[model samples]
Target: MRRNDHSINRAACYRSKIACLVFFAILWVAFYHAPAFAHKVTIFAWVDGDTIHTQSKFSGGKRVKGGPVAVLDSEGNELLEGKTDENGMFSFKIPQRTELKVVLKASMGHLAEWKIPAEEITGSGSESNTPETVEKASDKTSTGTGSESIKTDVEVLKPTIAGPGRKEIEEIIDASLDKKLAPIYDMLANTFDRGPGLTEIMGGIGYIIGLVGVALYFSNRRRKE
Candidate 1:
């Protein structure tokens, strides 16, 4: 009779673990994918040369294309504004040499921002400021008697390069990065689609059964005392 009771207890523990594991796994996936329990929308942006590229999406991987995008200066002045494309992508050139703020407003009252530093845009070949080399030239000029010549040299040092246009460069970088990141995105998408696998469910059930076994062992010891 004692041996039968032990076997029954072990079976009961395994059954309880499996039931709990399956219940929680289904509940978690349902809450994660269901619109009623979905999370807020999000946005991310990066600068490729003079153009800023952005992507916006809801928590469940739905694109937030056609969303309003606003570009602002450091002092909150509007610089430029536009809407995202069908793929939730927005690209815009830096208007002036100042700190920038890009804000995206999606549907359902979702909003996000990307704060870009002034150094990121400025000091580039396309932007302004080459004062380091200019200062060195001015120091040499100070040794002579041509202070005005130093000012002229400063202007010459601020050389601008004329290469591919902003939009073209943005497209090139985006294409390159997309190629590299495609595999990672595919892996994540597959993971979400597959949900919890058989091995994972079995592992979770095993852990729970081990915990219950330990508890039963302690309880049995206490009963004997």
Candidate 2:
């Protein structure tokens, strides 16, 4: 009857392992807390010329009105602070030339961060927009500074055929593009707000069940042999 006893012991050991796995699976589901908190807050930011604009929203697409926005550098130093308006937007001039991190302090102790790469910013380090150059272009023909100092034929002739200066035209185009592209940026931000859905949770459960089934099958086959 030694073989019979051996099989019984093997069966008992396998049963214990299965019980532990089941216990752990239940705990896993219980402790699956990160995904829930991940969607609680989200912040998105974009650059418009010298200005950095941010949008903050809660989980259900509600705007975080009047929320405080803190701008931080890559090294975690606070650069500036501002508050969101009714539309949940906070804007500030580019403080300095480096990678920026925008943090949103929403109500109910919710916080989120958005990072803006340095390259995305138009200029760097106290560099202002080239209104001076635009002015020069406007006055170049008047000064008759001669073709020697003029870099190109376009600069020499730009003042003649323009209702607005070239810089103004560029500003207009950029504004138009930003308006058209705002919806797309918002769509992307919304995508990030989503966490795991029911399908993923169900799949995790099924995976645990299937793993236990496989273990049980191997244990049974070994015992039978």
Top lDDT hit: 2
Worst 10 residues of 1 by lDDT: 33-42
For candidate 1, the TM-score is 0.44
User: TM-score for every candidate vs. truth?
Assistant: 0.44, 0.53
For residues 1-225, write the lDDT of model 1, one tens digit per residue.
Answer: 999999999999999999999999999988674222124555566555557666766666676667889989999999999998887778887788788888877655677787878876663324264667556654665677754554465567663533333434345655676567656644543343333479999999999999999999999999999
- Candidate 2 residue spans exceeding 4 A from truth: 1-39, 107-109, 123-180, 207-225
Choose the strongest candidate by TM-score.
2
Q: Please, what's the RMSD in Å of model 2?
A: 13.6
Which residue pairs show backbone clashes in model 2?
Answer: none
User: Can you write out model 2's per-residue Cα lDDT over 1-225, one digit (the tens) per residue?
Assistant: 999999999999999999999999999999775322224777899876668888887777777778889999999999999988887888899888779999997766689999999877743222435677657756764567643343355457685653444555556667777778778877776676665689989999999999999999999999999
| Residue 193 miss distance in model 2 (angstroms) | 1.8
